[model samples]
Target: MADKAAAQEFDILILGGGSGGYAAALRSVELGFSVGLIEKGKLGGTCLHNGCIPTKALLHSAEIAENAKTASKYGINATFDSIDMTAVNSYKDNIIAGKFRGLQGLIKSKGITVIEGEGKLTSEKTIEVNGETYTGKNIILATGSYSRSLPGLEIGGKVITSDQALKMDTVPKSAVILGGGVIGVEFASVWNSFGVDVTIVEGLPSLVPNEDAAIIKQLERAYKKRGIKFSTGIFFDNVQQNDDGVVVTLADGKKFEADLLLVAVGRGPVTANLGYEEAGLTMDRGFVITNERLHTGVGNVYAVGDIVPGLQLAHRGFQQGIFVAEEIAGLKPVVVDDANIPKVTYCEPEIASVGLTEAKAKDKLGAENVEIQEYNLAGNGKTSILGSSGLIKMVREKDGPIVGVHMIGARIGEQIGEAQLIVNWEAYPEDIASLIHAHPTQNEALGEAAMALAGKPLHG
Candidate 1:
């Protein structure tokens, strides 16, 4: 009910210009709607600025360092020098800067108004920023997330989170990672390749517990071989930091001391103090609760990205943003199942999976109603040539369609495109088997698994 005379109005108003917000703006504009995007930080938000882009750049640098360390094994004479942190960080910054510039250009080219300031929801369809009101017919909430910590475990000094880890000028000599989720495992891989002694403590029984059990086994084996130590099924009791380092004591009285301790537990939704409750939007445990269609139960309001729960991924945010825009445009976008969303952990041996796990499939269907086929990468000519080992496991309803595909190997994350298509499209094993994968490629392993599931094993 504030005066509308001085307020800016648009067809769509987006909050938090992250993956979801920016994507919603772009898509809405493309659909011939006037859009206004408000952001507190850089346009890219956490994914581009802190979380995804920067971390992936570090992971790629880690891969280069690892490859150099093993260059002699490939019959190439090259000295593996110590990692130059300055140079490595420069590379990461360069990539981020370029992407940031491009995003700014795209926003400008799309003719969307970009407002720079913190925005608070004043009503169901209005956001107040810097003493100015922005109103839209439809509003999309895409406030992202932040790194989370435990009750007593604080992040300061040597006890850090991924955000701090990303900004560190020098890699620690030794580090203890608090969680074994995607973020934890990724940092562990990077630090290990940088010659740090890394130990991961996971509360679950296995690292990357969300992945298929077989994939977890392979990852553990690979981590062990890389000398990356991990303690699973143990909970940390407390953490103490001193002049020397940080010590993490487990519930069972075991202690681990390292130069730094990284708390990679998970990310929590940043829905606090944003006036969501004031706007009558329901929230649970800090996450905004949205319906299958992403409605916020409020008039003309929708939520997307990490705040909306389900998969806390940037790409998922992108999809949801686009979907919400299309829905607002009366396009009636198809609802995507969260289970069909592809997940990839960029650790040493990357773990990528789409659709249900074997256990989940068996639980959903009867154990006898599902069939699983695992094709070892050892049989794949490309993997063997690269001296890497992994497996591609496909899960399907008995004599029905392929419901899941899980993979673990070097550069295997690239194959999730085909895997997700197969699962999301509900393609039968025989359907994929009829297709051809090029010779001596890592992708051939997926095709091999499909063929084996189709009852014709080319190279079992």
Candidate 2:
């Protein structure tokens, strides 16, 4: 245990050194404020150490395996012999290590005090760690989240969460993943590419249910083509694990047995026992309730990241962190609407969208006022060359600005930056249609969609 000091003070104190916390620290330091970043584990927290970096690394490895497996289609003489789990794990670990080192270097260079320990809020403006008190003029809560499981489902033996899945030494012969959200589908994609018999059980009507219905349809088709099995709109009734393996029973009495069961229901805020309620922070179902500006209704206190409850994305956390820092610095940053935040699921044939879904757009803007145009990747030169098929759908008001951009295709996540800007800035289709996109690129698909939406069809 470290010594109990009188107290250390800072201009800003951020809890949980994940994407959100770290981003806030960096921005606060740049604003010439003393920052204290506290974390129990690694500096990069879950996203870099366990969540985003590692998972994306696995997804990339899966993509490589898929590419090699289908190299014959590209007229290449190549064979994907087998996935070396050890080598794959090594590759993933290396990427995480490199990023972790870079993050630490950045924090050190910014002169932010990196406090190493678990911190609990002792008051609205103070945190206590290792029996030492630290006070800040302003305190930002960015505790992040953890994987959650269903009731009566014990996580042990062969049943695991993503945190355990990332550390597995051997790939299972078969897996039954519960919950077909972003995490479930991603792991299903990876395991399928690695030669595992994977099945996804989602209680929703479709996989990636939060996405646009059209995008979900395309993703289902792609997954079906890949022979990845999934059961949707059905809840599992029971799960039993024996020494040999695990068996999951659906509500319809259908049974699925696999070497392991992955519970990917979603993540819950890590707000329990953190003294949030004691500090008078308003919370709903464990998530800190904040105003549009992210205020916690307490003096000099604010919350960001997964704990704030909009999108659980690390990038969302990053943006919220910066927003909170700027707000504290009296920058009066414009509040970013959650709907406008870009979301990318890094599954095979990735899904990326910004702003409203078509249904959402119609509901909000009225069906009579909404217009949509979907451009198929089958018509795009680059997608055909890459042996991929997808669609870029644009939703806009009948004669107004584009409200949403939905896409499904290989490497489509890379196009989210422009889509986010377009939606957030309320750019009209004509405004984007006039801009030239590079020839023979997947991104040009967006331009094509915009052109068609703006009353001119180009290679549609």
Which pairs of residues clash in candidate 1, taking residues 3 or more apart in a chain or in different chains? none
Show the colliding residue pairs in model 2. none
Give me the overall lDDT of model 2: 0.92
Kindly list the per-residue Cα lDDT of model 2 for residues 162-252, writing each as its tens digit: 9999988798999999989999999999999999999999988899999999999999999999999999998989899888799999999
TM-score versus the correct structure, for each prediction: 0.98, 0.98
Residue-pair clash count for candidate 2: 0
What is the per-residue lDDT of model 1 for residues 34-96, given as tens digits with 9 covering 90 to 100?
999999999999999899999999999999898898899999888778989999989999999
- Total backbone clashes of candidate 1, pairs 3 or more residues apart or in separate chains: 0
